[model samples]
Target: MEFQGARNFSIESPGNDVFSSKYDDDGHVKRTGTWVTASAHIVTAVIGSGVLSLAWAVAQLGWIVGPTILTVFSAITLVTSFMLSDCYRYPDPVHGSRNPRYMEMVKNVLGGIQCQLCGWAQYIILFGTSIGYTITASISMVAIKRSNCFHKHGHEAKCHAANYPFMIIFAVVEILISQIPDFHELSGLSILAAIMSFGYATIGVGLSIAKIAEGGNHATSLTGVIVGEDVTSQQKLWNTFQAIGNIAFAYGFSMVIVEIQASYLSYPILYYSTQDTLKSSPPENQAMKKATATGISITTLFYMLCGLLGYEAFGNKAPGNFLTGFGFYEPYWLVDIGNVFIVIHLVGAYQVFSQPIFTLVEGWCAKRWPESNFMAKEYHVRIPLVGTYRVNAFRVIWRTLYVILTSVVAILLPFFNSIVGLLGAVSFWPLTVYFPTEMYLVRAKVPKFSVIWIGVKLLSGFCLIVTLVAAAGSIEGIITDLKTYDPFN
Candidate 1:
């Protein structure tokens, strides 16, 4: 296969398979999963620390464009997710494998080089997201502590809320909890993360509505936020782009779709002993579609409610984090509670999102050091004299170091707005829009310039352009803001 001048790999090619499904001498058996489980996993992937900042995202655009942008992206995400799900399996099952990781799918559908590019993009996005979580959790902790100190000590107390010690402590917790081996093992954590997400969303919306009902004067529009009737055109344009970037970051979840699909054990045996082409069981296909729809719809509702109410409450004054935007006000306790949940949720969310990264790195390392002791299992006596447990020496040391490095970066930067925006601007289009669209076109054998094909290509082009502009705008914003904290500045 050829895409433009590049040599593409056929997903049905025997040698290009992602998953190596094993078979007994007699026949092959595959695992399958339920839609409900997939839906839960999707919810876990989509609803993360980003939700905390969506009101601030909405504040970037006025109420009119904010929700609209969100809805548009949500729709696009659903469409892309469906497409990607369809591409999850090779048409000729015996020739290939199922639930290829995102980059694996890219490799099969696009080419090896494109796969490598997708791999880099995926790592950057997920690593940035993990860093974003560290920043979010640390900052939320800082705010919670500051809120507590202010209530107890009033004006005389001084507190270093955003300090290294807190981040170290937070990082330690993450390092400890991040040891879960795979996405399938995260079912309980995902459910808890989902619940925590709902709890915080409810708290945010509840607080926002309460504040709005107080009948106080508040800045409500972009003009008011900028504080001038003579605001320049460039500033408005910049603000719009930044808002789009932020919303993109807030809504970003495309990187984890393949991993989520893989979590389903009911692996669709899309090919039969006789058939060469793909034909998924109707129930499996419909389950995935239904799960993707239901999960995204639920996520969208949570985002909309939080964004609408939080922006309505604080309007122009809204901070990047809704809980942190509360200031040292009357509801300090609720703010503290919300911030704690944010930290907890980010911990689980970080692990969920980083699973793919961990898998890739571990696989590469294991491949390189097939006989190393680091890859060997070591048993340790269990606490309370229960039993023995096995541990991976490499995983412990490597992931701990990974968490520590991320924590150091979080402590040094400690800012979320521009970092997340920049990351989203850099990675969202390729992962969420371009790759899926292109893969679908190729796999479905849709002819070039046909109506549906043309529309998809246009969308892909538009998304690519948007991400470039967004990256530039976000980078500029980060540079400008970094002047305040840039060590060498």
Candidate 2:
């Protein structure tokens, strides 16, 4: 019930007496809590905005090949998730704490240079998450304005593209909600968005299918787009890299998920203490494996609905968020109704942006000020007001600096495109392609491999390939786009 002599509250699995999992053989769930409960869904959250490009990615690659890569990549990552759990876990008493704990162990396994590299990768990933969430918030706002959701609610909506005020408003609102730092508020926002999204998509997608039955183009389902007018090897190469990069990123996040296994080791007690754990449970831990993947089931269905119905009803003009593409699929009247939820989700997206930094930074602060309890952590402290504020203030300043630095690098990136920018410019290499594999190797105490480990080695090699290609392609695309924009040549 206690970890490292710290009696704290976190999500714990149901007692081994009632329900248990093969992955969670121990009586208590490991390292489990609210974080673990939310971990699985975090992928969708991480991949949330990027899903907009799914069709484009598929269009670039062969139709069947697109999902094949995803499936294979997902399977490999699924195995790697379990593999990561094994590598990082101590079957006996001590558990590798979550990502940070795993990082520490990996340092010991790989030695100084590699450990530092791994640390940097994690650092970027942590911040990369912030960037992706921020971009999603920005993009969602634009999508909302384009939707009838704004008009129906009768909100003053206008062009948000290049509008600095809208961006600032969102950023400020996000900062406030983030200040709350309670699971209740954040999860409430996430759940509302999730439900509206999943719910609407299901209904719309069904209607779409019915429309198709009433003689729509069946070829949309069984269709392919041959983009890249010239069809050069470089374009093919770029497409391949993007696909691989997507796979590796998916796998990378999955590796992060196993730590959720250890995290939940303490969940039951934490939730029980609060009374009616089910009442407090969130999607990933509570709804995923425990409820037979219910949360993701809901999510996947929603996504399909959005993709299919949006595609079918709105055609190519499908708006990517909050039924913004209502005009694409149906009348603007739907957009009118959707306006309410759109605001709700802009708030949600803002929460997503604020949360990662708040939680991650607060964790750092807690360690620095270990002398203080929760009350002190929340409000004031005896440790010199300026000093306490300075420590906290420095974190905010540093994180902002890092965010700015990341944006600078992203802009500098040759491929201004999100996927390429992410993979090449800043985020991908450190988190997905590098950390998990190296951490696993480090934990294994060898720079070598077993037969099964050979599989990991090959997979890591593929990841490296994807990483290089993605980065290169992104850089190339950025240059091409820039040159085209001005045409100095």
Candidate 3:
């Protein structure tokens, strides 16, 4: 978890090739990542199931507030990302010690309670994201079935498919994939997930444009859904709050910025050189900043297109998930393809988010029970083509239980938009806005009561308020949905 300074490790190896070609100044493997690679990672991380709710979010806030909220959240993510990027190297931006993990950076810059808070916020968000992904993958699976049903039996036929079975199937897949060991093993999966994300997003945007081209007028307004005609005044207020949460969720990728930057380093070795060698040019912080800007810009553009165009296509009645909500029933094949892409993307994405938690808990258990075989033992199992595999009983049982728990939670609360909104509202300010701002203040030593200080504080305060109300609204939405619904029905 912690990286000692370069001076502590012995870098002198018996060969010139190892010293010259393999290691960096910091004793870790040489970093080969560029801003382009980091941007690609960010794009993959930032765009996920959250984008599916944007049209519904836009419908809630209407034309004026909808796009504005998206823009504002985008700006907030970019600014905070820049702050966290600079924190990657401490004391000095170019020459200071590298903090590869987010918690490590927080501990170095803003230790004590702040670091603990960051850890809690980060892990909670990751856990909640697993549940959200489960619900999303199931919905997509059901959508695929429903799309086929609609195509076969006419669009008017009943095509109700329970989400529970698909959710269980997805959870079973995750339980098996969860044994992949660590993040280093997930590089190919991450790339494929990123591609799938783009595929589905493009499909969504293309479908929305096609819907718009059909020239069907969708009633929309500057202020969102009308009170009497569409929703009650109370409902409108709650929905607006929930919509803000949805946007917040869409922009919630700040927690992993440090990890993404750290990923630039190939894998750490046992020893490092004592002498200061040349580092990757521009520093990780600088490259990460560029990546953050580029990635967020691209993500926001996609968000605007998908959200605004989908809103234009469906107007105030845009379903929480436009693809699965039957917004475009004619192109059944396209819808099915989009849903399939979603399921594939979420499969990889679920692992990406959940691996850290697995590592954290498993590491803690190993430390706590160093002498126990249950925690430290590995069993080798040989397969036909996969060759030998190492499996631990503790890992299998613990990870399986974790997957089952998340799946059960998803089954209990299957409201997609509401769950997304709640998770976003719960995490956005604490992880995205407040911690990064505080860390930046400590790192830069900005004078108290200065203009920058006041502005950031104000921004953090406003976001906290947004978080509170958004949570309230999402909770209300869930409660409203629960009234007429039965769990496991």
- Which model scores highest in lDDT? 3
Of the pair 1 and 3, which is ahead by lDDT? 3
Candidate 3 residues 1-489, lDDT tens each?
Answer: 123565666643555466657766656677676778777767766777789999999999988999999999999889988888777678887778877666777889998787898888888988998999999999899889888888888878888889999999999999998987766666677677778888998999999898889887789998879999999999999999999999999988775465543442221100111011114686767777787888899999999998999899899989999777652377888888889889999998898778778888999999999999999899899989977777999999999999999999999999999999999999999988998899899899999999999999999999999999999999999999989887766
**Candidate 3 — worst ten consecutive residues by lDDT sum?**
267-276
Please write out the lDDT profile of model 1 over residues 63-180, one tens digit for every residue: 6788888899899888987888777665632333554466667888888998888877777777887888888787788888888887888835785554567778888888877775
Instruction: Evaluate model 1: give its TM-score.
Output: 0.82
lDDT by candidate, in order shown: 0.70, 0.44, 0.83
Q: Could you tell me which 10 consecutive residues in candidate 2 have the lowest summed lDDT? A: 268-277
lDDT of 2 by residue, 1-489 (tens): 322423463335454334333123222333234433443343333333434444344444444665565455444444444434444333211243322244444555556787677556655555564444444444445554555445554345443343233445555565445444344444556667555544443444555565555665433333333334424666667655554453344334432343222222222111121111111234222322332233334444444443444445433222323244343334454444444444455466444434444555667877887776541334433455423321244444444554455444433331314342344324444544455566665565544657756876788776666667766665565556676542111
Off by over 4 Å in 3: 1-4, 11-22, 261-279, 326-328
Model 1 root mean square deviation, Cα atoms: 7.3
RMSD (Å) of each candidate, 1 decimal? 7.3, 8.9, 3.9
